[model samples]
Target chain A: MQYAERILDAIDMETFILARDEGEAKGFMGRFLADLGFTDHDIVFLEQVGPGVRVRARAYIHRPGGSYGWLAEGDDNGG
Target chain B: MVAEKKKILLVPLDPVHDMGLKLIRKALDDKGHSTVLLPPGMEPYEVVERILDEVEIDFVLVSRTLGYRVGELLARFVDLVEVSGLRDRVTLVVGGMAVRPELAAEMGFDAGFGPGTTPGEVVAFIEDRPFAYGGRAEASEGGKRDLTHGFSYVYRKKEIQKRLAAIAGDIMGWAANKTSPGVERARLRFQALNKGEKYREEFLEEYLDYCDELVVLSYKRKQLPDQTRFLAQDELHFLKQYQNWEGRSKAARSGIRKPDVFIQYGTGCPLMDIMHIKVCEAWGADGLVHFDPSGGARTEGLLEGYLAHGEDGTLLTWENLRLIKNFLAPNTLWQVRAHRGLNTPETVVLAGELGADLTKINMAYASLGAGMDPARITIDGVEAIRWAAHYDLPFDVVTNEELSGVPAHKAFAGMLIIAHLALQLGGRPILQPLFCRSPEVMIYGQMRDNYIDYNAAKILALQQIIDAPLWPGAPIGFLTHTEDRVQSSLTTALHASLARSLGVEAISIASSDEAYAGGPIAAASRVDTLRATHEAFRFFGRAGIQPTPRAREWSKELIAGISKVLKDVANSGSFVQSLYRGLLGGPEDGAYPGRVGRDTLLRKEKGKDV
Candidate 1:
């Protein structure tokens, strides 16, 4: 019934961050995930391109080997 | 029961986007339905008036692709249909890239088809029948494909074949009367699983002697290894709920029958693995290969229970395998690797009893690449091959030892010997050559010009030696991927494209996180490679990827090299001694005989290992 429970696993957020380097991009992403109320998160990828950093951030709504509420009674199976 | 066709009206409600509607109209016409098409840019009022002018239009199909104010425009059109009092008479359907089923239903449309909507799906909707999405989403209809269905498994070149046969004979002769604790455990496991619950304790009493302390702790106290845990009662119930849930999945391939894309899943937890399997299956993965923890391989035995781990490899357990197996889409080919482990034969027994479609066993890779003693693994691997035959499980003899700097010819020599030994033991063996950017390539610059020719040469060379099914990988494109998801996925997709061109039957593909060693693979990373592979297959369906003339030269070199290695292995007094002396691969070649399970081979007495 909860929105987070709708996701079968984790959700990945990919975007471009205006940062000087990979470390700065990672710092911004950590804050971004924190500001978005995510705790179980990781910066899966970060690369410093010409002007900005291309990054893929992930929030683990459900870690593996744990209970998946998404598997519970539901109409929409989220990816 | 076939539904009777009726008159239909197709309206492309957007400018210059009538392609979907035109496709639907053609499909409807093919199904003997009457249809009138209004070109793109038709006003909603004009469409409504046209429907009204028609003497009994059973259906009105509208397509809208332009997204700006689309919801409001659709809502206004639905209100117009309602005001006309014709909503009850006509089944109003909406479809296009901008449409969602819920959004259309909320807008008062009868149904909606979104992007990637096929023509047959629209027909299924109009005919009021359930669309099974080629029976892939729900049931099997020609879906349980055999990867080795047509391969003849005959040697093409007689000289190489003669050498391979002699080498394999020497290896089998050496392995014939040899046994190990691993083999003993496999026999005990076979007895335990078959003989009823009453005999379990008795079986474990004998089986535990062979198991390491960590494994014993897991069974006796229900204790878990580091970073691993057993699923709680509530979590198990949730998995049970998943067992009854029916979901949809499209095939990853765009219609090419060979080269089924297989993904590896083992997030150290059966629950996590099930989730990954669900994701991979839904994304069109045709098969799943179970990856056990490397530590578990070095350990003497496997554990049981619905275990979850915080690491990369899933712990090999009968309970874990059965739990994951229960959730696999019936059509997805399941491969439980019995390769590179102390429990090789035992894993085969578990994989077989649990209805696995395939198993992987390569004694050479086990000894040289995975750090298992050549002598111990050879004894157990031979037993594992026999069990593979008994269980009707065709296994891939992977030449991943090349990753440790072994050349393709030497690795292929080992692979061919094992494959030949499997044939002699009545087991079907698939040749798994790596389409990798391996150590050999980095050292020799064989792949400097392109990743295609050397890979093509490997396949071409193997084809000359034997007619067995070729499946190019245990995660193709190894050592070529980087931590960058795009690069990782692209390399995987490109290698898969090459595999399709070379006519391979299956390939073990890595997730987009293949190069990332810092964490367990993310679900999104898996999707990246699967989607890329799907696109690649779609992009290059039967077009063929051409390798340069260098491929023929490399193929000839590889064949000659394999023949020389096979001759040396056959001439060696003892096959086990040859492995120790590095006849298959040597120290300079970045390969050394394994130390794990070294000097552990036990002699069999009266058909039982002592």
Candidate 2:
């Protein structure tokens, strides 16, 4: 997964994510991560292998509220 | 052998400013020092305990902004560090405003950093690298000892000396760059303050009278076009809902006193924005004042875009205007923001000439951005007024300043005086002083210094101005919502309750849709509910009234302070200049990064070459 998707997943889903192009995504992702409210989430990196694609996701997850779940849907056509 | 990146602890003492901590963090981080930020307000003992228990920290940088308390806190913190036996292990560096470097060293701090320490000097101290410590290479040898032994005291002493040198360098840099836009603004502020005997005699009396007039005038302006998309975002849905309600007309609305304040949800969110309007209307608002600095960019666009959300969204164009006109009273003028670069004075003049009831041109920061000399703002204001007049366009001039980091007294004085000038020049003035508070106040619900005072003083001053007709503009209420804070509804209810006691003639409540999403139909329904509650209360009687002696005292003191500040700044030359000086190193003037210019002010330290 691109870095931007990982950072956006850290915050409440209500917050909208805007991306102008593919290239601006990573830098914007870092900034977006820095702006989230103080959440005591440990950084977790998850890697999922699909039919042909490998994706890495950097996530901040806490189980205090049982808001635990994985956003791992393997893609059939992986690049 | 590679040396480990040393851990550093940064502690920002209470009663001190936060900028220095942020600046030092950036500088040290760049110089390969792994720094940990201790939250503000931790006691010195707790801090010492944490340092002892945690990783081995090489240096402790403590910041104290307030003057006398710095010595006391530094002494206590140093004592704790010594008692903890880590005194030998950790270097101590004290930095902040009003810190006497020599005195700090005497108090047992190995080094002292006063204001203006550069990042490069800090880097040299941290790395134990051979570089110019102060400004000269000669002082470098005298300032250093072997970093291996007595590492705590030796490291700290060298860091302090380097920091003092950095301060001098920073001041010299500022002196050289005094003519830059940021510094010129400061110099101009000081100049406006020292407006000599001659200028004062010529202008002070007229200025005071103008101020007095602003105090008495009742400002009125055009409401947003009735049928604008912001208002029509949920009009069809609202109409449908109202039609279904028993005995209500298809046109009978629930929340908005008029369609103008009830309808549009600018791009940010609808709850606060729209809720603000409903509250204002509930208070029998005289007119609506819309502040879309970016001209309702995304929020309004969402409604106009009609991306399968509301199928019958076409009325958002001109038809919404017609609907709003049908719903509201004739006193409304939909004041549109017009600046030179983004908006043409002529287009707005055409708007007024084409029968726009009011056009608002804001000339505080935008005036500066457009390269308008401070003196030229008056010229811009005059030109806008002249065009409006020539075209028989009735319009208002507004200063939409957020006034972050400014003291309340300065903001109120400036807004009142500027509004008075607009009124004198034949244009109605709209003053949105809340536009100038700290983001914390706006976003986090923390009270900016003098927020209540400014609010009260503004209301009283505007009341006097409207009554006297000395200036053309009157005080119009802004429908501010604070949903992010706790008990926001209760807060709004309390605000309305207090506003009633303050005797404001008009007020605004945003529709429910404000500050959440665009003014969708669901949001409008929420506002309608609030409007009904307000109307129901009005229909019955005053919401129970009782004021404690303390509450009354606070109210009086706040208003009085606001009055004094206004009087003082007006006595000086430009209100704009005074306001700028109030936020000399703050973010509003674009001096630094992050909120209130804390981060920008801190990068004065330099990183050493690795």
Candidate 3:
């Protein structure tokens, strides 16, 4: 099983990024997730605080009705 | 076998916050190891000098509360130790509020323990044994609680009890000669499953005769409904793997005594439901309520097989239920709801046979809110109660009609009637009042002041009349949540804490996806509310949320309203007729008599089958 597939559901990444506004925070989150090689992701929560934005990003490893990689047999991704 | 005691040195690197080291020192002493404790605010070089000056030390445990310059300080300490030639002589470990094992390893320390590390872990490290975090031993501490455990099922108000008895007697008489296809199927299912294979074929033939054509075709020809299919073998295999992988670990609780928590799971697919169930179980949910499809309720008969649906509620089938039941933790209470459906009796039968701990049955809700015919549901509901009692399954009489815009008083009246009927039939029934922002509340502005007073009023009113178990649900915080996960989870947590403060037996809470109608509830959403509720419980441990004096006044009014409703039903002479006549809850009150099983009851002749 791949290491990423081992995540039972979605992976939620919460962080505070130095951004001017909500839009900038979303952009930073999108770029950050893309940089991390996350293709399937969404912004679950976002808030603009004083100097930065508090953000919660979600990348779904497996969704219902989709064939789960963890269930499939293959070489271990060693996540 | 006792291991050889070794010299251990405990050093508190932090000027303050030396409690962690002190705890470890006590544990090391208990393990019969000689330990030297260094006072706080000692310089890193002084610690190294003490370690070098001392005799052979087995392990050096240093505790540091992480701060801005603490990392640099620790690195310098490690450099000093390396220069002093004691680096390889002893195992070096660091632990504190912010120290992670990875950080320690990066800084050339042997090991690190962060917050929540127990003393036993340090002892295990000293003994050279592998330490597992959150051991399964603590998981076994929680056991299934009986929600109906100390309630006497006695009516405190004599007037309500007298009126309810009269109505219950009328219901018993009215249902004496009445039987529906639901009741007959339940009987045949019991006989077919228990008697033998010969009886099974004969009973199935008779069973299909009473079912609708759709159910008959699905059973006889092995054809499934649209958007449904039998679960693949690999799906079941993966599910078993997931269950075993999670293992038996109990979710951590917040330390309050009353109100066991429950979460509802019905993600259409049994596989998905099991996944959600496992998450809820691991996050301290005390019980689970199974929500089957709304279509399944309106349909005449249930489909068979390990089927998965592509919609909201899980399909209610014996195989499907058995699969879910097999994977639940031993201590997790499972409730298969038979409250609002054409197959109420058979649902209860399946739940009972499959080892379900509780079931839900409400004739008034089924008839008025869920669209089942008044007479049909009464007969089936009565039979369901009988089977529930026979199987020793305690059911909850849920008053969700309030969500349909019925006032709390009318809904409670209906709930108490079904509860009294269940009691009359020797069944234990828990009263479930919804802790929600119902439409009635919106219309009447009952909660315009605060949420606490009105909810507390409902509980007080019920307590004034009866002494049964009160479980505020289907899901509390109904209509109060939004699409925001934070808001939804917080609302659910607040309602849960309020329910606990009211000292109810149990509460069914919603996922953080309660108000998010865009898609199916994600597995992570279930953990959000559970975590929030855990925090809420921790925040308000034994400190009550006080409802104002208006609660008592509302309670008195609610009791009077319920009394008036019960009296009307008693005077009507038949419970079914009262339901049809809208004595309990009428069209104006937002409850309309359902017509799904209209005129479906058959009168039984003396010693003859219908």
Candidate 4:
């Protein structure tokens, strides 16, 4: 699927989070964020990959305003 | 009675609009009239009692900006005034956003004021001052004074004369600005004939009623002496048909009911051109003007002939005038363009005396120089009215809110003023909606020329102010490709029907090809399809219920939002630039085809490789 479509599909209006687990999704999201010109953010792993696997998955993109929303895995939220 | 400042009271409905009311109050005050404005929310009973008890008023001005309940509310107020026995004692003049003079007259108000009413008008009406140049006295009986006749024929004639004379000077000023010397000369000669007493005897055989002023020259007479010629057909069949059309129009005007449609075919070859007149006909229209604008291109010859001496390189000549005079229905509301910078006071003076009704001009065009010029326009029309005082030749001033080179709101404000100015100058003012057409959408495209349409709601909001004859030109033939499916015909019928419900006087449905090329016969044929489709809707299942209320409300909101944007931009003194920036700032790929620049399309159409 196209990236935009995938990003749309991954949106969770209820939970306000990207992927099911935050651990493994973090590494993938980190590289995507770097590609999207995000150099000054402190990334955090909020969830785990495959439940038991202790993967540092990415859950959010931090903004300068200190008001950050959840970002989907491997998707760059750039203006 | 030119005494001290007259005290005026303005009472607005609490829950309704106060914008128009506030403005009128200011106008009255600025013009040396003392004014009191009662904001909406007070009980009508209490409000009246309070005003009666408090203020020593010259005139009580009630403003109602609320909709639907206007008539009932007005009746209540009238009843209140009558029961209080103050109707005759006080010059009870009511002005409001939604009030129409005609409707207000029926409601029993001594005078009704709509939007765009100037500061001086209220004063003049209240002072009971006759117009400086014209007589305010009721027409005096001379040759024909018999009330025994069934209808007020003589009175009606006198009324028409009085009305026409009031606006004649404005018409002359308008004509002088545009008409060629040749046409001007002809017009003058024609007026001279009417000035002579022989015209009454000459027109006796034609059974002339409203058209007593036109000096008709028979077609058979070679080199007819009069300046205005009514050319008859050489062929007897055509002549008979011409006579029939005149008779039919006369009957329609006589208040006798006739068949709904009376279509006339033009003399030009059928495939390329066709001219027709639709009288007092309803296209499911509401609030639209009952006036006509088809004269711009249709009667260009007459306009050109008047502007340029013989012809302005346009085929319009004395012959064309003769043909139209003999064939076209009598008292056809002919149009004249005032903003074209070509019409002058002299032309209107001549045209009025020669008996032309309804001169449509753009007031915005005249006021483009950053200052207002009312006296110039008024005096010109007034002069014509003087010469044609007996004919009752009315000068119809048509105005718009958006012109070619003005801010939208300013243009709208100007439109309101134009109508009021017309009435002030003693002429009838007709308001035609300045509709925006989308040239990017092929379904609604027409040669990249833009007519602005703000949210449809803006027009409705305006209806909240001035209730003059409103003509809403709606999109008709934008849906062409549907083979009986959701096609242009169906969509147009729905929109036109909606427009009617909105109270438009005339609703026009454009053709599919109008966006690309000048609307030719093919386009008109498509329009015919729309008319047929509309006819079917009346017969079909969902016949006459009000259309998409949600859409209408949404449109109003959108217009309000646009107005906010405009207000913000206007504050910076670059509204046009702001509009362009907003429209052009969108994603390049997302841009509609019409807004992408006409040159780009012209290149693309020619298959030129960029």
Instruction: Report the Cα lDDT for candidate 2.
Output: 0.40
Over B1-610, each residue of candidate 2 has an lDDT whose tens digit, in order, gives 3335788888887644667788878987876779988888888998898798778789888877645456777788899889888899998888776454455676688777654455655666677663332211221233321111211212122322333233223323332211211222222222333575466444333322221222112111222223332334564455433222111011112222221221222323222333333323322333444333232211111111221122212222122323333333233334433442222333344344334455555444333223233323333344555455554544433333333333433334344444444444445444443422343345534344433443454444444333321112112123344433223333333444444445432233343333344433343233332434344334424444444344344445544555555444444444335434442123443322111111111121331111
Off by over 4 Å in 2: A1-79, B1-333, B337-341, B344-351, B354-362, B365-378, B387-403, B430-458, B461-490, B513-522, B525-529, B532-536, B543-610
Query: Of models 1 and 4, which has the larger TM-score?
Result: 1
* Candidates 3 and 4 compared by lDDT, better number: 3
> Using Cα atoms with residue i matched to residue i, what is each candidate's TM-score against the true structure?
0.88, 0.36, 0.83, 0.36
lDDT of 1 at B447: 89
Q: How well is each residue in B330-376 modelled by candidate 3, as lDDT tens digits?
A: 77889999989999999999999999999999999888789888988
Candidate 2 chain B minimal-lDDT segment of 10 residues: B593-602
Q: Whole-model Cα lDDT per candidate?
A: 0.85, 0.40, 0.85, 0.38
Please give the range of 10 consecutive residues that has the lowest summed lDDT in model 4 chain B. Answer: B132-141
Residue pairs whose backbone atoms clash in candidate 1: B268-B309, B269-B308
DockQ of all candidate complexes:
0.03, 0.04, 0.03, 0.01
Task: Report interface Cα RMSD per prediction.
Answer: 14.6, 26.1, 13.9, 34.8
CAPRI-style grade of the A/B interface in model 1:
incorrect
* Residue-level lDDT for B258 in candidate 2: 20
Q: Candidate order by lDDT, highest to lowest? A: 1, 3, 2, 4
Q: Kindly list the per-residue Cα lDDT of model 4 for residues B1-610, writing each as its tens digit.
A: 5546788777775476667667767776766778788877666676668556755766778777636776787778878877776666566667766454545677887777764354555666756663221100111112211111121112222322332233333344433333222223334445544567565354333312111122122222322222323233343233343244211111111111111111222322211111223211111111111111222222211222211111111123333333333433332333322332222333344344434443444433333321213332232223333333333433333322222333334344434434444554444544455443322222323313321123244446455444455544323333232434235455545544444445444444443333433222232333333344345434432333343354356445533443444344334343223223332111221221111111111111332322
CA RMSD, predictions in order: 10.1, 30.6, 9.9, 27.9
